[model samples]
Target: MAADPPPPAEIPPAGPSSAATARAGTTPVHRLLPVIVPALAVGVASALVLLGISLLAEKLQDVLWGTVPDALSIGRHSSLWTIVVLTACGLVVGLLVRMVRGHADPDPATTGLVDPPLAPGVVPGLLLVTVLTLAGGISLGPENPITAANIALTCWLGRRFAPGTTAELWISLAAAGTIGALFGTPVAAALILSETLASHPGPGALWDRLFGPLAAGTAGALTMTLLAHPSFDLSLPPYTHPHWGDLLSSVVIALAGAVLGLTAVYAFPYAHRFFRALKHPVPALALGGLLLGLLGALGGHLTLFKGLDEVRVLAADPSGWSAGQFAVMAVVKTAALLIAATCGFRGGRIFPAVFVGVALGLCAHALFPSVPVALAVTCAVLGVLLAITRQGWLSLFTAAVLVGGAAVLPILCIASLPVWLLVTGRPQMQLHEDGTPLR
Candidate 1:
């Protein structure tokens, strides 16, 4: 009743208050505390989860390659073992998908790394199947499953622990961390996210938006490097001297690789449709395993796994492989990748694709001895990645990272121009709705 009851005082929106404070150049230190706390928490949490998943996979890999072969009294690299292990892996995954709740993770052939977060309850099955797939020498990478698991775990933890952290923000940090750990560098995360993060409207500068993810990525990458995990760099001869001729050669080699990759891309959906034609998961996957076994028998143990180590070993001594041998390895690797992706295996194709590219590049170099090995490899990687991922910056970054040669950076950047032109508007290595391609 005092002065007809003054209207209740309205509280200003927190967003406006923060914006006005920032504009006035007088934002309090506490105003930034929320961001800093969540960023650090996400960083630490990302490192821990990534570390656990990677180590579990690594130990399983040891058993698959070491203990199992020893128990079977066969060399770990024996062709028979490769065939048996891969075929068994396919059946195991099929059985789990048929029996498990949520059918484990979604089909990786139809999914990408940045898909929606996975259901928390489904992670254990996904992890188990992923380990089996990797240990059995499935031509797929841990990127998709690992990234999904990290996102699920991080989002749950953020909601429970950091109420201020938004879901999208947490997901971004999780992906960055997973990528960083996989590539052994925060730079990889930065390059991949550059286009994505810049497209969104956010507070502060673009760098500010990148700050949290970068922190998380750094933490994950550092942990991975400390554990002596495999890296993208193959320690190829450094391109200390960049020649103009190399540019032409990079384009030529890259185009060749792109052609090889596109061949596989075109075949991907057809292969998928063929397997799915079985009309059921078990028989389809089992048959797919049989095909993979045949591939293993042909390609040998070197072509069986995700291909990082195999690619490294191949690149280390280019003189050891003749053009025919390199050609066979590339063909077999690409075929295995296609079969593995289509056959209901829960894995990504990037790692295997890199292997194919390395083989192709080595073949190209062997054919044309005048072409620098590093240039051939970088260009091949760029072209194959463009065909598969359809991401220009990622392809470029990968090419640069593979060589670790500053001289090669400009060459890759320039070579990417033509590669993109060739690959743009083509079908990606993914399935489409209504059985049509994205093209």
Candidate 2:
């Protein structure tokens, strides 16, 4: 199913609305009413926004794909076209950032863990720009914007009504719930939120904290279902059941994935810094696009865009490509992604990373002729991003979920084990407090 469109207007949470916060005399239950009502409001509003965004995205995609083949035919094969579109996208991003000046691009890593919430209006801008970039093939995904908008929308509503908990916690719950609904797995999103929150110090005990997100997740999931969001039934093909030996192979694959993940984390920050140092967003974006174009030239069109459609297409028909081409695709995609991240474009890194890993897994299966291609892709995706995101347990489960194969469960577990070992030690996510850099 196609993804729902993002929120329409960027609505930042109106600042503290007179920091008095829920009149000191209100009863506990009475106070609770504010949060509860707002939470529900957020769910409904966000769903509507997402639906609109999805429709817009579909229409936009039609225009883009229609023009793309013609552009390619006219010697626009080099990533120059991607760069041109992305540069224009960067300008749009810049214009919005300048206009609303909301949380720049609604960074994904910050959302899942409950970082301080942005003003309410932030969601719509993010939704609009992300839709524009993604639909235009700017090498990013909608997931970040989706999750960010959900969090922002909820927090905005919460602040308007509740004004009790720290805006930060509400923001976290908003993020958790949004992710939960989007993925159609509230448990996983809640776990991810809990684990992420645990990584840092905050008000409220684990149980107290879990209450909001659990409710939010339940609500979010309901919203997804009622709206018939495509993610409502996220499932991959079932692979052959895992054998004991497959577990051993998983360990090997996990280790490899972890290494890549860690490297990505370490490298991304530096790449981002390098481009920012260049100071000119246009030149930096153009340069990033040029590198992406070179990668596309080598990897074929598969490396182009955000790669979500490609992932779906590949999963549906894994037999379409030979191993060598898959391997090359993985390499080129990695380069393209690194370039995109380093550039000024704002979007999520996870999906693109998964795309690269999946292609690589397909290539590896071809070469080894032993491991199931699907299994290898699943393991690599979970293992690598777990390290990169610094969420081992979440990564492990996410990997298993991505594969959607009960038979491959053992293999997924095995792969995650070694990856876990390699990825030992909690890595801190870069977050901001009061909109200022924390690290």
TM-scores, each model vs. reference: 0.89, 0.79
Best by TM-score: 1
Off by over 4 Å in 2: 1-37, 67-83, 91-113, 121-124, 200-208, 228-237, 426-439
What is the C-alpha lDDT profile of model 1 across 1-439, one tens digit per residue? 1212111111111121234435565443434434555555555566666677656777888998899889989988777777677777777789988888778876656677666567788888887888788777788888888888888887787767756545666777788788788888888877777656544454555665676677777877887778756567788877788887887898888988888899989998899889888877788777878788888788777788788888888988999989999989989988988888887888877788888888888999999998888888888988898898887777888878888778888888888888888888888787654444555
lDDT of 2 by residue, 43-159 (tens): 555556656776687788666555665756743444555555545555665565556556455433333333445566676677776776666565665656776666666666666
- Residue 187 Cα positional deviation in candidate 1, in Å, after optimal superposition: 1.0
RMSD of 2: 6.8
lDDT (CA) per prediction: 0.77, 0.60
| Residue 297 in model 2: lDDT | 64
lDDT of 2 at 313: 66
